[model samples]
Target: MQKTFKLLLVILTYFSASSCDDLFEYHPNQIRLDSDERNLTATNLERLQKQQPGDTLRLIVMGDTQRFYDDAVDFVKSANSRFQDIDFVIHQGDISDFGMTQEHKWVQDILKDLKWPYLTVVGNHDLLANGSKVYQQMYGPLNYSFTYGHTKFVMVDTNGREYSFNGKVPDINWLAKELAPQQGEVWQQAIVVSHVPPYDADFDRKLEASYHHALAQSNMVSLSLFGHIHNWNTDYLYDNKILYHGTTTVKNRGFTYLKVWEGGYDIRRIAY
Candidate 1:
């Protein structure tokens, strides 16, 4: 009887320890950066200097990297080595599981090590509490647009309503004006980057309606890029356009590589 009791206690102790280990597993946040890390460097900036006209630009895209901070770091490092000649980077948001300040700092710390320019759009998890303010202060403005290689890249604030208004980013009015074609432009293509996609069921219905219409009407748009679904995917929204859905960092443990020429682009996933 004493031997039986002792064996039971040993089993219980072992199980308890295992449970604790599982409970204390790594939980990645935005601010948990490496101790030796600093922000982006001059060399990194130099690497992103504007490309000459007509050059084939290479950019990399990453899906939801909110959790798995170490995985995110590893992903970037692996991608850097493989895509040594990349021009720019774009993260599809959810850099944090809770959009907390610490999570943002952590991810940024890892990101600053990249030898290329990078951009991040907001994700659902990134808009939790005062996330927008933290994101703006740490990163930059939302709903901003830039041009590269005859391609117009629009970063829309899809989580605008997360604060108090509608999650309807890409302000229909502003986007309408931005999407308006400029005279003398030939063979223009646009890429829309957003956190929540128009087809996401949990997103605001009214906002989705307005934004979907706006995107469809944006005649120059060639692709809509999003990452909330956490899977490798592509959808044909229009005859001339396709929506590229990126996979989550935790799911596929990979990122997407993009090769863009003057008129078209090719994207593929690179797993670690």
Candidate 2:
């Protein structure tokens, strides 16, 4: 009888340990991650910088991956099958729904399967709970810019409503500075990318004109890209010179393919 009891205790102990390690989590908001999951922005940017500059820069623009794990996985498969000469994939934001680290990790796990490196913008939903911190830790800055070939991409944080319309969420000063020198020695074209469009009610009303004016006046900024609307749209809102492209959500199984050269760009909507 004592032998039987000892065997049962051993089995229980093994399962208890296993449950602690695999099944039970202390908290859903915990910011735990492996080395492979951290500092993804810099890692991907390094890969992007190393690629040869082609005449036509082909990229996949998709976003709003919130609460859509199954669809996001399918998106990876569809994106892979659709394009071959793509440079990289740009996720416009909402990497998480509840701002949970696990959601971000799940999305990353799926997007990591892509044959090309991917970049992300900070979405309003990504600011929930400890989401902003997790996003910063995993993807780098909320507002950042990088130049590839002759094109410079300026990604900013435009989730004004999330900040209660604090008027500083988009950081117009930083954007103006980034847009000031459009025709840099190396880069001649500029593209602004963000989550919430300035036209959206979620954007800070006070800064909307300034934001649009910044892009409109920039000789280098010919196009701006955004997500959060969950619908495809193309417009020349402010000056009729700057083209703004808004992408749909991954839940809708749609994305935009962008092709840009030195002087012009083209966009196509793809649904799968």
The lDDT of each candidate is: 0.69, 0.91
lDDT of 1 by residue, 90-192 (tens): 8888888877776766677788777777877777677777666666656656666767667777777666446454554547787766777778754377788
Q: What is candidate 2's TM-score against the reference?
A: 0.93
Q: Each candidate: RMSD to true structure?
A: 9.0, 2.2
Clashes of 2: 0
> Ten consecutive residues with minimal summed lDDT in candidate 1?
35-44
lDDT of 2 at 124: 95
Give the per-residue Cα lDDT of candidate 2 at 123: 97
